[model samples]
Target: MTRRGATRNGLTRRGVPAVLLDVLLVLVALADTWANVDLGQQPAVSCALLGSFALLLRRRLPLTTFLLTVPTAMVSDAVFATLAALYTLASLSRHRVLLACCALTYAIIDFLPWPWSTLRANELSGTHNVVHLIYAVATAAAPVFLGQLVQARRELSLRLTEITEAREHERLLTAQGVLARERAQLAREMHDVVSHQVSLIAVQAGALQVSSQDPEAKRGAAAIRRLSVQTLDELRHMVSVLRASGSRPTELTPQPSLADLQRLVDGSGMEAELKTDLPEGLSPPVQRAVYRTVQEALTNVRKHAPGATATVRLHHVNGRVEVTVTNTAPTRPPLPLPGAHHGLLGLRQRAELLGGTVTAGPTPDGGYELHLDLPREGAG
Candidate 1:
């Protein structure tokens, strides 16, 4: 047999196959009917048989099955089927009124004589009949109360399972949030510490290249400066990717500002000029956006437009800060370089986050221009 078939054959809830348990209950009901039913009474025998067999339908039609078995309890002493059916109904139904009515009907039917004509008013007042009636009522209530207890236990188990799953999901989300924050912290450190130190290296290399008299020393210094700039570019890309993983905002330390624009242009290795008449005390985010825009524009010019001279212009007018980076056409063929191609996209995203816009395109004269415009107060 397959594993599923074996499981069906095996013990279910309390070490008894569900199908076997049903069959055993049916056999017990049949036995009860045979023991109590009078074979000479055709109607009584028929009702006993009908009630015994109606147990099969209890799961699908609990109320109908219970009503079918009520005739057996009314006419004969066979009451196992009626009690079983009542229990099934109570377990499945949520209506207390309906269950109470069914239980009361069973109790009254079992208490009174089968033939209405034989039940005299004086017999109802007899001590033996009163005690028997109480016993019948208690018997009928037993199965109903037991069924309700089982139903309550089942509902409680389901509720507990749901609570457990919810807690596990919350724990997973908390762990993921912690991981994201750590990644953002690491990215910030790389940007503020590693990137800054590398930029200084590149600047020193450029200075050495200019002052050194030997041609070999100048070549070495230029190579160091070029490689350092490339490393800085890659680091910037990594930082952007890492920061994107975190949903919550975190403050980045040692933020670059407009004051760093002159130093950036001087260290870019290309002939670049910075012209700005902007006022001081601008928001840090606004200054950083403008600075990153200029940096990315200069990097792209070096990569794709070799020997190009660039100009950066920054100004604030009419409650808006506008930055424009224009570069002349290349003087020679540019070298093929490896890149993630995310620089311009990152700049545009940064501008958007700060309530700004970035637009870049090639000029009619074969030059390229990038423009960034931002609100004076940045995004609220």
Candidate 2:
């Protein structure tokens, strides 16, 4: 069963047994009172019946039951009154109700005399002895004490349940937060890769327009368009993989790795020089992280550094993979702009999630540098 269903079932199981026991107690108390009081004693028998029935519903209506049964028991001297008072004092909704019930019970029983009064000189001491007062007080007080004990136990159980539920809620929220962060990182990656491919298509398409007479140029432009379209389809498929969870279907997929770094270098065409030193068999996630870091770094170089030559370096060392991309600064400084840099921030966040780090800043030799590190397999 689900957790909620199991909890509810457990409560029902515990309560049903307690209710049955209470009903049996009521029956016993009623039988004993009826046997003790003669049928001629109308007031005592009526009181016994009222108090016994009240015990049956004490859990549901504790305060009312206590009030109704207390007065009748004092008059009739019935056992049912004692039991009902106990149930009320222990199980009532609040301390105020319990206190009120206790005071009312004592007042009712104290006012009524026992089986005989001192005024009747012929009456035996056994009929109106100190024992009657002790018995009456003990019976009335016992239920209240029992009720308090039960209340304490119930409160403890409730607090424990609240603590358990809070922890479960926190766990669920943490999982959802993690999933949201992963989705955002994926979006950033998709933007970088897809934008680079689309930019190539646009550049090639523009060249074809200006050099319409050159057949070779037109053919190259058409090829770039087709390649961009194919890559877009694959990008969509990868995004689908992210959004779904199940057994993955195998296919001939061209996932970018160190080999593809050459293509990117060629595409940049001397805007930057790419030097890679990847191990023989890196995990797919590490490979992807490496490829994305390079792509984003180079893209930034193209946009910000312009004519400034940049160098890309990667190496595996000391249970970690390190990447450093450095580019010489331009002779003239660029103007500082206002808006935040989301691209680099997103890249750093992605790196941190993999237990890695990214550092980017100006170098001593009038150049900009970005460094990244990914923890090696089994080095967590």
* Each model's lDDT: 0.88, 0.68
lDDT of 2 at 106: 69
Model 2 global lDDT (CA atoms, 0 to 1): 0.68
| Model 1: per-residue Cα lDDT at residue 324 | 95
Best by TM-score: 1
lDDT of 2 by residue, 300-349 (tens): 76567646788889888987999898988864455454546787897788
Poorest stretch of ten by lDDT in candidate 2: 1-10
Please list all clashing residue pairs in model 2, or write none if there are none: 86-143, 90-147, 90-148
Deviation (Å) of 231 in candidate 1: 4.2
In model 1, pairs of residues that clash are none
